[model samples]
Target: MSNCKKISLSQILLLVLDIILILGVITTVIVYYNTFFKGSGNLNGLNKFIMFALLTVGITCIFFIILELRKIVLTLIKGNPFVWLNVKALKRISLECFIIASCYIVNFIVNFGENKYKFIYLDSKGIHTDTEPIIFILAGVFIAILANVFKTAIEYKEENDFTI
Candidate 1:
C-alpha cells in the first residue's frame, strides 16, 4: 500500500466538525443565558425546565455524534478505515441522531394543541411545524445504512487478510 501519512479530506472534515461542535456549544450557552437568565420572557418555570431538559438531551446527542466522528476520522487518518471500531462508532452516531430526533418529536408532542408558546412555539394559527427533527430522523436512517456498509467492508477486509 502507498504511504498514508499525508493529510486527507477526512482530516479537513474533522477539523471543520471540531470547529462546529465548539461553536455550537458556545451558542447554546449564550442562547440559554439570554433566554432564561435575562428575565425578559413570558415562559413559566415549568416550561423553562422542560425546554432546558430537551435542549440538554439534544445537545448531548450532538456531542456524542461529534465524538464518534472524531474517532472515525482518526482511524481513517491512520489508514485503517475498515476497522470494527469504526463500525461501532457509526452505529453509535446513528443511535444518537435518532435520539435527538426523538427528543424533538417529544417536544412537539408536549406543545401540541396549545395556543400559547409552551415547550415549543405555539401560535394562534397552529403549532410550530418545525421539520428539523424529521430531517435528523432521516439522517439517522442514512447513517445506519452507512454503518451496515462499513460492517460489510470490514468483513471483506478480514477475508482478504486471510487470503494468500
Candidate 2:
C-alpha cells in the first residue's frame, strides 16, 4: 500500500480528497486559535466556547461526509455504484451536510447582534468568508434526492434482473 503503483482515476481522486481532509483538520486548529485569541478582545468566554463547539461539530460532520464519499467511490471503482450500500452512504452524506449547515446557522444566530463582522475573517493571505448555511442546506436536499433516485434505480434494476 505504501509503494507507488498504477492507480485509477477514482483512486487518484480519493487520494486527493483524503489529503484535503488532512489539511482541513490542521487548518481548523490554526483558525481556531487565530479566531478566538487574535481576533478581538471583545469576545467573551461564552462566545469563545460556542464558537469552538460549533467548529468541532462542523468539522466532524465534514469528516463523516468524506468517509461516505470514499465508500461511494469505492463502489464506483467496483463498477456497481448503484447499490443499497451507496444509497445508504449518500443518505449519511446528506445528513452530515445538514448537520454542518445547522452548525453554521447556530453560529450566525449567536453572533447576530455583535458589533464586529463575525461572518468574515481576515488572515495573512486575504479575507475568508464562513460557510453559507443555505448552500449546505440546498446540497443536503440535492443529495437526499439523489439517494432516492439511486433507490429507484436499484428497484428497477432488481425487477429487470428478476424478469430476465
lDDT of the candidates, in the order given: 0.85, 0.86
| Model 1 CA deviation exceeding 4 Å by range | 1-7, 115-129
Error of model 2, residue 137, in angstroms: 0.8
What does candidate 2's lDDT look like per residue over 41-157, in tens digits? 666789878878898899888888888898898898888998999999999999998999998788778878774334578889998776578789999999999999999999999
How many clashes (backbone N, Cα, C below 3 Å) per candidate?
0, 0
Off by over 4 Å in 2: 1-7, 36-41, 115-131
Residue 23, candidate 1: Cα error in Å is 1.2
| lDDT score for candidate 1 against the true structure | 0.85
Error of 2 at 92 (Å): 1.1
- Candidate of highest lDDT: 2
- Screening candidate 1 with a backbone cut-off below 3 angstroms (N, C-alpha, C), the clashing residue pairs are none
Worst 10 residues of 1 by lDDT: 114-123
| Model 1 Cα lDDT, one tens digit per residue, 1-164 | 99867777988989998998999889988978887788638767788888888988998898888889999999988878888999899899889989998888888777878843244576688786567787898999999999999999988888998995
